[model samples]
Target: MSLWGKTDSFTYIMNQTKNLGLAVNVISDYDRTNANEYIKRKNVLVIIPSLVENSPYTVYECLINNVNFLASNVGGIPELIPQEHHAEVLFIPTPVDLYGKIHYRLKNININQGLLNHKTILKKLGLSQLNEKTTGAFKKIDEANSPLVSVCITHFERHHLLQQALASIKSQTYQNIEVILVDDGSTTEDSHRYLNLIENDFNSRGWKIVRSSNNYLGAARNLAARHASGEYLMFMDDDNVAKPFEVETFVTAALNSGADVLTTPSDLIFGEEFPSPFRKMTHCWLPLGPDLNIASFSNCFGDANALIRKEVFEKVGGFTEDYGLGHEDWEFFAKISLQGYKLQIVPEPLFWYRVANSGMLLSGNKSKNNYRSFRPFMDENVKYNYAMGLIPSYLEKIQELESEVKSLAEHQWWSFCQ
Candidate 1:
């Protein structure tokens, strides 16, 4: 098939070649030498559409000569295809029912359908579109106080959860907000399903999801904020339900209290496990000082319900993404406090925060994501533990952690506080 000007077909083929480093040549009645050269090269990719006239025979001749191929699955062309072409020749779904087909293709966004199951490919396309929309909106914000409010969330194979999370913002009472959902390397069908459902609606509702790979929550949220256009930034959790006044409350707090960061009291309900030590901390939540420098910020806000003015956030360098899962928010408050920024909380609960254990957390995600990222915080934790003589309880683990810190810090893997 021809590259066929600037269109989806052309973009799809070009992106494939660009990403995989495969060469594609849309051929014509070319001479024997050129055809032979293409046939001999194992890397060259050829795309043939069954809808094109008499092209299956031509593509078959090239395939028999050992040319790599991708054929559009259309009509009865498969009946006449050559044997050697079976493996390399991919049958792609043909465009149909232009209006209805596009609509159906869109509905396939959820990845429940067979043809649209190529979610990784679809996500790349989705991310590309996200980049276009986000870049333009971001460019308008010359500084941190851009008119848009950026609410960042991370998601994996939880479209059911994401659809609700995204809808909360899209349906938010505050209309001048932008929602940025970061994928964090989710290749699952559910991820794409959520993407398709949220994509057009998000764009229409003035929310945009930043398309990303598996960078973990800290990195994903940080990455999304870097692309935000609003004067205020709210860090959000995907599984939680926000009240319509969530953003409005945050903004009002920021404006009235003249504080840099504001968060609401979250109402959390635990599952069957009762409550872990970490989960217990979520109870008896209190409002931290409006000026964190004047008092302590031990419980500023869970990553679940924190919002900050963009300038103060930028000033404190956002969340330390390298912290992975745990204590990233703690480090954020510490650094922001050290920078003399105020952190306050709303007295009322404006979000339904679900406190539960995730499979990933139980299946080593907590460890892996936190391992390298938490090393820096562990150093400080160690210093305190050793000073308080709590080292006896953790002698072996401390030694191991100490060695890791020494090796990584010696190599400058982490930027120590200057």
Candidate 2:
């Protein structure tokens, strides 16, 4: 109705095609069932003008739906104009105001929801991005607590799985939490059905559904982060189940340790098989190590059960967007560890990270490729993991070779080939 800003911004929001974040993009979508060709684009920014607040879809797109960034001229918009970590809160007076939807507000210029001309920026401090796929596991929080907590679940093509994950949160002991579902480019009929379920069934529980760009997990999480209001934030996956006390435990731990990040082991179980050996490790938090060698620690990298203080997440600039599909958490952990943030890897198995057999090796390979791709940007984690997985095998092979050599030499004095 009120075309307050230039047409480009409105056109951008109105013409969004991908269903990547469609659930979150579509206001009140409960079933989360739909499919579309909406690609989660990057490098392009979105500016949600104050004028479109009257539009039914404005809050969904502006808040939950992922955008590189957003700039808004704030006022009385949607009753629930999605609030991220530091999207312009309470609204700004300036018409051309920028609210750094992905980042936070600075003393100088407010970052628009969309384009952030680095040159126009007085100082450019990169904000951390979040995983496109966050979880919606609910947990208890005290009423007097300083900051509220919100749990976000990001889903791509796994609508049925997403329901299981969200239901676990819905059934949590914690009632003070909210659930935000991120539809990461899953524009299918089934996905839309699930989105509708979330919006209609759980409205009283502060439930919200959103869409994210075709952008991978990092951006998806970042997109969810854009809409979260909790003083603290928690993550979960669509396919995994959460403990009744999952959120309660993490919040308690965060309160106890005063650290930015805290994690507990996720229970590893299969449909009908034994748990993988890697999932059986005994250790919890990554044993602290020097920067050069920490990447080599196999125990430190996985995200089966992990939590980070919201402040710590914002401080670390979130997950690296470059890692579209894999190794995003590894890089995130490495970066935060290097920054002297206190972390607690709780030994308790409080969550479930489903490493299903359907795509087990394939998942590992993709993660490995992402690790290799990101290895160049950071440290040589590839060599580190390779050496760890290989050196033992090489040693065993050498021992066998020595046994053969010894037996052959007994038969013939010069058995070098053996």
Candidate 3:
């Protein structure tokens, strides 16, 4: 009959309640203890009208005190309530329906009978009871004993896109995360200003910022890794956004599989002309089958879409700083494979990769130097593999000539001229 909270419809509510002969209590602010006691002793039904919620903790109190509850079944509220309590909790879709439910509950007509299955409720909320004790999976995720994930991000201008990437990490379902931001010498005044503002915002949210006087992706990332103090390190790009469940999904899969490195497919953002490698090559799961060649390394898992244990990085020695155009991830992962470390594919699109219509490589940097540097990196790696006997000499011979194969072809006119 009456409404609470700050509302502009006070006049309408007061007239309606008066006409219905019901007293409407209006309290602007009150003591927390008194309110809790009042809610426990007096309130017959608690109605939460908000259609959107992150997590409704008040519902927990209501359920614990054995009070009848009603709410709009939108956003995360429905998920918080147990499936068995669907009918009893009264997820009314409209004002008329809410009134009808209230009338039924008032008459004690057993409208919500047999709807409180606590076991199923706890399970839906990712909780359980072993023996007589309740176990909370959500609680365990934030405990100090849980593995802390270090998310390493490198930035060089593009303030337009960096905010989204940072926000994605903040929104992750996994809570034990420490963000390491390495600013690779932002040259522009606007970039510096924007980055300073962003730094202030995220510093309060638990992100560490490292500064560099020069621009190098490999070096910047290595610097960030040095500052990280987590059990695992997940590399991310400034241009990409991660899904909310990305970390949780990857961490769970990694723990279960017991792999030193984990990779996931990425969803492409902003360019239909370019297709994701995962979409094109669905069978590219790791533990790369018998293909210890140069080309295999070219198409291996990407660092932006992967998670590596900290020990693996320490063993292989972070990233190679020579190639700044960014082939370090492929080379690092390849070395791990050759060294007998296990790699597992999560087989899900966990992050977004930004692609433009023209220019630039997958890393979002457009430099002619990349083509020249990447070639030697690939060739020298193959040569090393051959010298180490990891790959056969015949394969090495084939790889060496791959770049000049077109020029070395025999001409058909030579026989006619002779």
TM-score of each: 0.49, 0.50, 0.51
Per-residue alpha-carbon lDDT of candidate 2 for residues 92-201, written as tens digits (9 for 90 to 100): 53533443332343332233343232333313422322222223422224665435667867788887677667767866766667776788888789877777766767
- Candidate 1: which pairs clash? 110-193, 148-230, 184-213, 184-214, 185-213, 185-214
Tens-place lDDT digits, model 1, residues 33-135: 8777765565444456556544356554653564544556565455445444333344555544333333443343222112222466568769998889767
Which residue pairs show collisions in model 3? none
Model 3 root mean square deviation, Cα atoms: 21.7
Ranked by TM-score, top first:
3, 2, 1
Off by over 4 Å in 1: 1-147, 270-284, 287-301, 359-418
Score candidate 2 by TM-score against the native.
0.50
lDDT of 3 by residue, 268-301 (tens): 6673223332444333233232234542424444
Clashes of each: 6, 74, 0
lDDT for 347 in candidate 2 is 56
Lowest summed lDDT window (length 10), candidate 1: 108-117
Q: Give me the overall lDDT of model 3.
A: 0.67
